[model samples]
Target: MRSLFKTVLDQTKPVVDEGPRPDDKEAGIVSDDKEAANVSSERPPSSDGDDDSINKDAQPGVQKMEAITKVWSTRDLYLAYFLIWLIYFVDAIQQGMGTILTPYVTSAFQEHSLTATIGVASGIIGGISKLPLAKLIDIWGRPQGYLLTMCCMILGLVLMAASNNVNTYAAAQIFYWVGYNGISYTTTVFIADTSALRNRGLVLAYTSSPYIVTVWITGPLAQSVLNGVGWRWGFGIFAIVTPIVCLPLYFLFAWNERKAVKQGVLVRQKSTRTAWQSINHYFWEFDIICVLLLSAGFTLFLLPFSIFSVQKYGWRDPTTISLIVVGFVLLVFSAFWEKYWAPVKFLPWELLKDRTVCGACVLAAVLFIEYYIWTSYFTSFLQVVLRLEVWQTSYIANIYSIGSCLFSIPVGLAIRHTGRFKWVALYFGVPVTILAIGLLIQFRHEGTNIGWIIFVEIIYAFAGGACVICDQVAIMAAASHQEVAVVIAIEGLFSSIGGGIGGTVAGAIWTGVFPQKLKEYLPAETQDQWATIYGDLTAQISYPVGSATHAAIVAAYDDALRNMFIAATTITIVALVAVTFWRDIKLKDFKQVKGNVI
Candidate 1:
């Protein structure tokens, strides 16, 4: 039986890389296209290498991917692995410490409610940038893409540390998320570029291993940083260390290009078009117009929902109505443009049209939505409401990550050994996820023990871990090497949109609803203090535990957070529906997208 849904994926043609399940041949999706064939036959815009010593024993149809994989020797490949692990390590430490501090930073500006607003910006940036970055790497090369993203990350960290207000901090966050998404996408594509199908999941899991070590230490580390020179330095420290570690990887890529050129094994192509032609070329090639349309439409449509009731005129505000109307108009036009008129289709329609690819993307999207809705402010909730120490709260907050990272390895191995993930994800992951989230919703009440929270978090983590692995492999199994980059980028595209929606929902409920709840629940004497408590984490926590004011505050939080959890749990069932559409692909060498990767 075929799936009842469809989604977009695939590059125009294919390089002889990994691809969709053999059973999907009837989709007639993977065909030779002119542009893709050209890429495989000719040198790219930036050449890595073309050593005859490499790919001397090449398969008949794998020239494009072969050029990349065979260029690295066994030792160089190991070094690339080390570099990949090092980057993930550095990023994990930065995120671990930085995430705990975001609430305090917003509180410092008396706009603690704006944290989800910041997350909205992050989700949007993460969504819009992946396709552009993928296009950039395809046109230029891996080295340039990595270098650009690293600079963005370092600058963002510096700006965040020096920020004087919520606006500036939000702006800094935009840059940071862009860089974060770019680096993340580049590394993921690198793994695909190097590995065969069988070990791909295992290799991806290995990159996440740093989180296991960092999660245990970061709680105390973040607490100390917060307690000492302040949250500014908490962000500032990463700015200094990121460049020191990242520069080497950039140099390694550049070194490869230079050596390949010197050995006469690489030829660099130079464009000869007029300036006007060049401008015209990239404008359409990068699809800048659609990017603008989507960004404006999504932000306008989503942000009004968040700020509507809090605005002076509530949802009746003229500006809110105008924004939504205009946003809808622009989005409809954008969809039409992509489907009919655009020179470069952001997603190739015919090349996609597969159940496995669509299902995997939907699965990834819903998982992120289920997570971000409640988690954006969970760390702060634990510290104030539960009255746990900072380190203790941080540990519990991080338990989700620890379980996910630890469990990813075994899930990956299982997929590799069995060459199947659909049953595992649909049968095991979905049920456990539902159970965990339900337990968590129940546990949010007053007087619940800390141990129960920890257990539920761990349960959610393992379930989430398996679901993610299955989603990733299932999606990749549906794209050939030529088509895989687009598949990966679109995966980010949909997932980040889900994140944006989750943030909007959480922010709307919290900003527009929580304040009212606070007013309603506060003790009579503390009624006037609701604004102070809402704006200041310090003031919120200053109240004695078990006091009427503190109890009231906890009650208000419980009500607001409960709504978000209920919203997320309902979406989990949709993920099971999404999983049903994936094809049970076999990850055999003949079906591998790329040459034998590490």
Candidate 2:
């Protein structure tokens, strides 16, 4: 089997038909004294005039703009990009539907403790499921693994649509988890294959831009639909379309799978391994420590946020909150255990130690937390403070997606050309943090215009979106070539953890502060009714509250939003400081240097 593996790799290794030639002027090798000098020096020497032109082309401004145009015009790349985006869109719709239908699900199964725990169970199980799936991608080719996962998602959605009880719904989440991991790995592997070293950064950026966009765009529609009809239909709609649309597209644009076999991308092919074999042989050589650290860090970070809504405070019940706290502690312990005791670490220890990589992780985590808080709880602010309708809220959310789309390509180009990512981080990230914080502080005031809100969000989105691209480039630069996939997986895991934590934190803060703020604003009689409506803002905020209670409810919502924003701002500042200290490693010369930052 080992011999066969070696044979396959030898046969597939790319060969350059054009071979070496004469050191002096000779046939087939346009060689001269200077050319000979270039070979000896290990640098491509150029004439003085060519050097001048090259210098001009490499200028920060000119090259940045050129890279931007090249990325924009690369239509062939968009096929894979669009497919992944569409799949994410479907996932986004599902997420929105879950939020929108929370009220209905609560009402339908309120009596059953098991039923009430269904959604929570689904999230935890799904997260745990991803680790094994990650291993599978390392073993099986990414494309085939991804196709199989899509099938799993489609099947899960079908089951979810048919489910009437909480148990089945929980099962659906597990299945959906399997599918999501598959598609994500597929898209990642595909992009890596199709893109060249020169444009790799842009390819990654192009693929990821849609991640935030799809959810925001589809979330509101799902919310609107849930309000108009029932939530079951939302899942049903996806189940019907998954096979018809997403599945076929997965195969049609399945470029990654074919390329893997053709080139033998990984060192070993599974055809030589036993059917029952594990993927240990194909594991990333040195990224284990970082992966473990990130995964654990996120698990710890996620727990407190996940149970924010259910935790107890001064006046609230402590039962759920205590349980959540315990869960969070367990997650922390797990991280520690993985960091200290895991026999085979999944994270790269050295990379984590690198100032640049560490700083990038902190920056990405902080920025993501801000993004999540705004995303998860902004709807509450819209409904509770401004009294917007569900449809109206959805309409406004589109601004964020639009903003991200507008900024993504430009940011990708800037990093590719200038190789000056730290400046880009400062330029875009600082303003976004400021706007987000300012909006929160001013939100509780008298002159909160809708147009102003829209304007701020657009500005925030543009800056934030650009910062994301810049940060990803930095992260890629901070790792070695062999660690690229592992580092990306680490990034994805941490980013998701940041979002999860932010969501939970916002929920916790909102729930903790809501009652006290309500006491200050609403009449006792109105408070209980408002609490139920608050659970689903799209259902209740747009309608008029009586003159008596309106001011108070609005003020309370603003106060809660203000606190969350302040928290977000503080984290962003920490992230910025972290970025300032990062060791700037230029990635444009990756081909020349066999490894990246470390």
For candidate 1, lDDT tens digit of each residue in 1-598? 0110000001011223444344543322221333233333221111112222333333211333344454545556666767877888889888988888888898999888877878776678667888877777766777677889888898889999999998899889878988888888888877776776656777777777777777877879888998898999988999999989888877776676666666565556678999999989979988988888887788778877777765778789998888789988888988998988889977656435667778887887888888888887687688778888777877888887778877988887787777667877988887899888888789887678988998899999999888887887777777755556667888888888888888888888887767888889899999998998987877888999889989888988898889888888999899999887665655652344343346
lDDT per residue as tens, model 2, 213-251? 454556566665666666777777887877665665555
What's each prediction's TM-score? 0.88, 0.71
User: Candidate 2 at 133: error in angstroms?
Assistant: 4.3
- Which regions of candidate 2 fall more than 4 Å away from where they truly are? 1-82, 85-134, 155-182, 208-224, 227-229, 249-336, 339-341, 444-447, 524-543, 592-598
lDDT to native, each model:
0.74, 0.53
Weakest lDDT window of 10 consecutive positions for candidate 1? 1-10
RMSD after CA superposition, every candidate? 8.1, 11.4
Error of 2 at 323 (Å): 3.3
User: Pairing residues by index, what is the TM-score of model 1?
Assistant: 0.88
